[model samples]
Each structure stands twice: as structure tokens, then as C-alpha cells.
Target: MVIMTATEPATAGTAQTETGTEIETASDAGTAPGPGPGTGSAPGAPAGPVRPVEALLLVDLQSAFVAGGEAVPDAARVLDRSRALLARARAAGALVVHLQNDGAPGTVDEPHTPGWRLHLPVAPGPRETVVRKTGDDGFDGTPLGALLTDAGVEALTLCGVLSEMCVSATARTALARDFRVVLPHDAHATYDVPAAPGIGESVPAALASRAAEWALGDDVEIVARAAEVTFTAARPGCGTGSRAGSRTER
Candidate 1:
């Protein structure tokens, strides 16, 4: 990940998945760095030409996970930061894609159910739209990859719920696709893991989120705040930076 400042050094540790499976990996729990000079614009500032056109990918920001009484710890903060990013991305004419998860029948986020609805209102247009997925990875069986490619999106900022699940899975694929992925430290969250027999005590949501981000390796750009991320309009027909059919990690 691109450290915005010298003060913010990256850190890594072990973490567990939602299924109680443990994975020893790198973690980035520290405050993320901001964009380097000329790489991003301040809120309401014109997008800089030097930065490649970028996109904003909101993964599973559904009401089931981010709203009401069942929300994750610090859900309010995640929502607020995500909302701020959406507003700024819209103002800058950046490509915004909201990945909505369609939970199975009887599940909290069942299709067309209240909990399945998106927490934030979507402004559907050529630049902004929603993609529904049935899995943790947004691009697994969705048109997300095509959409990004058609728009010539090279870099993207990812935010949303279940830091170790949908959010982390999607980010991993985005990185493999060679997208310059930027994950704002405060814009994503997950539920506190329940204590397992002999595994360990209950893990805090904050720490799980950190472990998830850290597992993405060092290809992603971890920013301190959502406001620190900037966007540029997608350059249609310009082609994407994706390494098609290649699974090599950067």
C-alpha cells in the first residue's frame, strides 16, 4: 500500500474470517496516509490531470449491515465517511459503483427485503449505478469487471461493510486486476466476531477490519480518511489497466 506520509508506517498481524477460520496475514491497523502531491484533489477542488481517471466501489453497503440495531460497531462513522466519499465522487463526475449483496431467502438481506436495500440513495446514471452480487467477491459473477473496463477505470477507492468478507474479497480481486485500489481506513467495518471454543476471545470489529485490509498485501493504497481520496471522470474507450487472464500478484 502507498503510505501517504512518513509518519504512517504499515503494520501486519494475524486475523480470522467470519466463518471462524483463522488466517495468519499482514494487517494495516495504523492511520493511513493521504494522497501524494498532485495525485488527488481536496473536496470541491478540481480533479488534477496528472492523476489517472479513477472509480469508487461501494461494496455491500446494505441496510442489513450498515443500518438499524444490528449494525456493526462504529457503523455510524463508516456510513458518514462513505456518504462523504459518494458526494465528492459525484461532484467530480467520477464513476461510482455500488455492489449490493443478495442474501438467500430467509436471510436478513433477502432480495427485495427492507434489510436488502442500500443504505445510501443511489443516483443512477452513466457514471453511477448498482451491481448486485450473490457472493463475497463483487466481480465473481457480476458485470463489475466489464463495467470498469468499458469506462477505462484504472484506479478505484473501495468502501463498505463486512471488512473481512465482501469488502476484503472485492478489494483482493481489484488488486489482482491491477486496479490501483485505495481503501480508506475509516470507511469500512464489520461485526464483532463471536468467541470460539479454544480459538480465542471475541475479536473486535475494528481489529478484524484492520486484519482484512492488511491481508490484501501491499498493492492497495491505504488512505487515512475518505476525504483524502480523490476521483477523476472515467475515460471511455481508453481501455483499462487490467491484466486480463493473468493472476500474478503485484
Candidate 2:
């Protein structure tokens, strides 16, 4: 079952990741400093030319879906891949958006609950920010579309949890909007499907992930590994240029 539903205060603080890069909360969006040049090389920067004006969309990598015992079967790999992808994007100065889903009351991801928090640390700033969403589609009622447009994002590399729900729905919309979408095979995951009368036997999470990717159609560039994806900076005047920065999208 795809359980989709799911901010913070102003004056957000920052913490250092293992590598010492400062990570900020979504509340610091727009107000935090933008990335400086000469950060680091992208994950696959040497293997290929840096792609142009691309964004990184991380969907619902919340603790409820990617951490501890309740996590997806492939949660470990998803974390590793998403972390690498995030580092690469930030390093190359790409726009990075983290989508957080709010679950209904009594659910594992109920708003303000421990499980509802994002599992990974976000580097909120001009080019990187978080968007809280209520529906499976990240852009449904959020500022995602406007942010992408304002940043002049022509393509994007997307990764996260619940491959069949949030990931699939968001990707579907990105395609419809004509964004060159790239989904890494190893970066997104989901839980197993229990046996049911209509579906018969249970389906493993890995199979389900593949099925979700296939359903997105050929326009979406599905790659084998997350590392194969490269990155580039968002266009000039991206993060600080519009109303998207000053206001939170509900």
C-alpha cells in the first residue's frame, strides 16, 4: 500500500556532515548562503561531461520509509546511493530539492512525529531546499514546478523511497511537463507487497522498483547506477530570483 499524505521555525541552524559540509534545515531556504565554486567533483564527473542545468529531486526519504526496522528492504542501498547523488549535485552546484511527505494521524509518518523527519541532512540554501508535500506527486500542490522553472532546470536526476508511489507519481508529472528525467535503478526503493487475492503471491521490493521504473515510459532516462549520473549548476539567478525563495509552498 502506498501511504502518502505528509515545517519548522525560522532562524534555522546548520550542522556539519561527516565531511564537514554545513547542512541546513528547510526553514533556512533562500536565506542560507549559496554554494561557492570549487566545491568538489561530482560522483561521475570524470567518467562523463557535466550535464547542463540539471536538478536533483530527492523524494520522501523520511525515517519511516528509509530508516530502522520499518525501512524498505533495500533501504541501506537507497541511502548510500542518495547520499552519493546529493554530494555530487551539491558539489557541481546543481539545484537540489528534498520532498517530504506528511502522513495522516496515527500512521508511522504522522506530522511532527519522529518517523516523519527526513532521514538525510539537507543543505538548505539558495540552490538547495526542502518542500513539504501532502500528495504522492511532489508538484501536486507544492512549488516544485515553479522552482524548477525559475532555476531553468532542463533535466534532473531523481532518487528516493517508495518507488511505486511518490517516486513514480513525481516522475510521471515531470515527464508530462517535458523535463528530461533520469532515474537511477539503484537509488529508489519500496517495501514488499503482501499476498492478496487479486495479486496472488507477494512481490519483492526489487521487482516492484523495476516495475515502477518501466511504467514511467521511455522518455525517462533510466540508468543502472546512481553514480553514473553527473551534475551541473542551476542557471544563473536560480535560487534567489523569485517568490519561491521568500515564501513556503503549502
Candidate 3:
């Protein structure tokens, strides 16, 4: 059952405040230093002329969702990728927005619980903005749209959990709002539980991947890897920037 809801504007200045800390503050813990634009090796795959991305949208990377219970395959891997993206966005002077899903009573993401908080391994800069969401869709009953608009974000690079649900749903909504949607394949993760335990026919990753592919369609541009994206200042009268070629894997 799909749930459709009206989109609300995100709170003004929802971006977080910088803690006056340097990028290397937590670099010792397996967090790789992300290369700056024009510094890193280009993605081997050919892509459209690279345009600057104004903002990075981190969808629901909460601890409750990515931990040991109900864990998605390669969740840790995606978290690492996300941390890299966060560093890159900060270095590029782009806005980073983190979304958190607050689960209802008795669910894994219950409020005030450790699981419901943003996961630790993935560190968001103190200045980055974070929004709390109660529903599956981040845009519903939340100020994500407004926040993006306020930040003048023309393109959105999305990564997070539950590809088929919140991630996919928010991507569709972003496209409908005329925002350029870029889905980094390896940047997001999800878990699929079979109806029956021993059925031996469950392929959650494939299903989630397909759902993301289908929902995005032409409205969204699928990026093979985060390293391939280039962010720049938005040019006037350009009606947002352009993205190269179709989606390819890293």
C-alpha cells in the first residue's frame, strides 16, 4: 500500500551550525579523506557534462534502521560511502541535509532510543542541517521541500536506507517538485524479509535496486558512484545544471 501525502516546506535555515572543528577532527576512525573536485581521478565511466550540485540529501541513516537488528546487507559499506560524500560536500561548499526517521511506539526506531538517532560511524558536520521525520516519506509532514528551496538547491544527491520505501518515495517526490534527482547506487542500502523464512527465493537487494531504478526513471538521473558527481555554483538562467549519460555502476 502506497501512502501519498502533501509536501511541506522544510523549516527555514534547517541546516546545522558548524562546530568550528576542522575536517580532520575524526579522520582517525577509518574515515577516508575525500578528494576535492578536480583533484580525484575521474570516474572511468563516461558521464554527461558535470554540473555543480547545490545540496546533498542524506535520507534516514539512523542507527535504529542500520544496526544489527533488521540490518540491510552492506549497510556498513554504504555508511562509509556516505561519510565520504559528507566530506566531499563540505569541501565543495555544498549544503548537506540529514533526515532522521522517528519510528512509532514499539517499532525499532522508537523516539529517544539509540536506534532512532543518527548512526555514529557516519558523522555529519555540526553545521549541516538535520530534519526529523515521522512517516516513511521524508517530504511528508516535513520541511524538506522548503529547506531545499531555501538553500537554493537545484539538484539533490540522495543516499540512505530502505530503498523501496522512504528513499524511493522521496526521490519520486523530489522529481515531481522539479528537483534534479541523482541516486548513487552504492550509496544507499535496504533489507528485504521474505514472507516465509526458508523459501530460499528472497532477493531483497535486487528488488530494492529495481524499485529505485523504476521510480526515478527519466525524472531522475542515476549516478554510478558519488565520486563521479561534480558540484558548482548555480548559474543564472540555466534552469539548473545538466547531468551526463545513463546510470552505470562503479
Candidate 4:
């Protein structure tokens, strides 16, 4: 796994860190119970008929990765955005899947290590799915793929720590599997690491954002922020329409 640090100054036209600030604080913005199966809406609008998305995949939002001391830089800044996405997803009735990186034994992220658990403030809901994996790619050797297929998901909205590592890998895997991927760049973060092990090199945020943009290709859509990503009521032929139901986790 290659750890790259980002040092580009926040610039105009780039994904802004506060894209979802308004939605995050609006008290009226609660999870809306989606329309039940067989009930469809007009096409192309917010109320348009949407494929039943059974899950919201969150990558490596663990304590070891987000809290101070072991946290990713700007991790705190992104929590509200992450939480806002989670809330909207739940309202639209998508399953919340939390992915945790399990390092090799004796490492910082090993099972039972402080770093292995998810960060505080955002807890998993009762029906949420939590999957643990020993590799950077959450789907590698894990049941994530099967669970998603089983739930009949047609798309995936991914967010979490380390924009260049697990998030990138998981997005690639999802695309290869033919699943529509939605990635909001501002909802993710990464740490600065010396590019040559000992030598300093900053992984430009533009590069990270561009990599995410490229990953989607003609199939994926990159939204500027999580709030811009629409979540609608599930309709029939789309499988189960329950909000906050089962979804694939990464």
C-alpha cells in the first residue's frame, strides 16, 4: 500500500471542504422514509424513480484513523460532511456499511487495537452493517461483494478516510463489478507522507481529486459534495424498498 500526502492549497473550482455545511445543520433535514415498492416517481428529478440502493459504503472511518494522535489530517473537518451524508442516506433508506482496516497482528490497526474501532460521534445504527478486513481493499477476501449482490444494489455512494488508499481501491473494485459509483470528493481525506520514504513529496489534492474523477469514467458521476448526491425513495422491480435496510459494505 502506498501512502501519499496531499499539500496543495485549497483552490477555487476544486472540491470545497464546506460543500455540505448547510445541509449538515438544517434541523429539518431528517431521513425521509422512501416510497415503498411499486410506487414510482417522475424521471430525472429528485422524486424520479431510483434503483433500490441497499447500502452506503463508508471506508475506514475508524478511531485509529480519524481521532487525534492517529487521525488523518483534516479528518475532523470532514466528519460533519460524512455525518450529513450518512443522515441523508438513512433518510432515503439506504443501508449504512462501515469498513474498518484490520492490519497484520501487532500493528496499529490489529483487532482490538484502539485504531481498529470506528471514531466517536458517528455510531452505527441498529441495522447498519460493519465489516472488518485485513487488507486495504475492503472487498478483498471479504463478503462485501456478495452482500451487495444479495441486496440487489444498483449503485454505491462511497466516503471515508484516505482518499488515495482504501477509498480508491474500493471505488475501482465497485466499478469493475459494474456498479454505479458516486464519490463526493470533499467527504474524504488523506495524510501527508514523504513520497520517497525519507524524502518529502506532497500528493497534490488535485491529483487525488482527478484520480477519483477518472475512476468513474463514463459510468461514474463525481459530485462536488455529498449534499448534491441525490437519494430517493426505492421503487419496484428495484427490489426491497425499505429505508435503512440491508446494503453492501466496503
TM-score versus the correct structure, for each prediction: 0.79, 0.75, 0.70, 0.66
Off by over 4 Å in 1: 6-53, 241-250
Q: What lDDT does model 3 reach?
A: 0.61
TM-score preference between candidates 1 and 3, better one: 1
Prediction 3 TM-score vs. true:
0.70
Please report how far candidate 3 places residue 212 from its true position, in Å.
2.3
lDDT (10s digit) by residue, model 2, range 1-250: 1110111112243333224344553321201111112323332222233234379999988888887889999888989999999988999988999887777899987766777877888767888887777789987877788788788777787899889999999999887776767777789999998999976899988888878876776466656667667898767444323333342211
Model 3 lDDT per residue over 181-225, tens place: 776667787876466666766666756565655555545665556
Cα RMSDs of all predictions?
A: 11.3, 12.2, 11.4, 13.8
Off by over 4 Å in 2: 1-53, 236-250
Candidate 1 local lDDT, 1-250, one digit each (tens): 4433322111223222223333332212245433333344342333222233378888888777877899888889998999898988898888888787778899998766777777787766788777777789988877788888888787788889899999999999987877778788889999999999989899988888878876776667666667667787877765455445543442
- Residue 26 alpha-carbon offset, candidate 4, angstroms: 34
Off by over 4 Å in 4: 1-54, 120-127, 197-200, 204-218, 233-250
lDDT of 4 by residue, 79-100 (tens): 7778887777778767566776
State how far residue 130 of model 2 sits from its true place (Å). Answer: 0.5
Q: What is the lDDT of residue 154 in candidate 2?
A: 70
**Comparing candidate 1 with candidate 4, which one achieves the higher TM-score?**
1
Tell how far residue 100 is off in model 4, in angstroms. Answer: 1.3
Count of clashes, each model: 2, 4, 15, 8
What is the C-alpha local distance difference test score of each model? 0.72, 0.71, 0.61, 0.57
lDDT of 1 at 90: 93
Candidates 3 and 4 compared: the better one by TM-score is 3
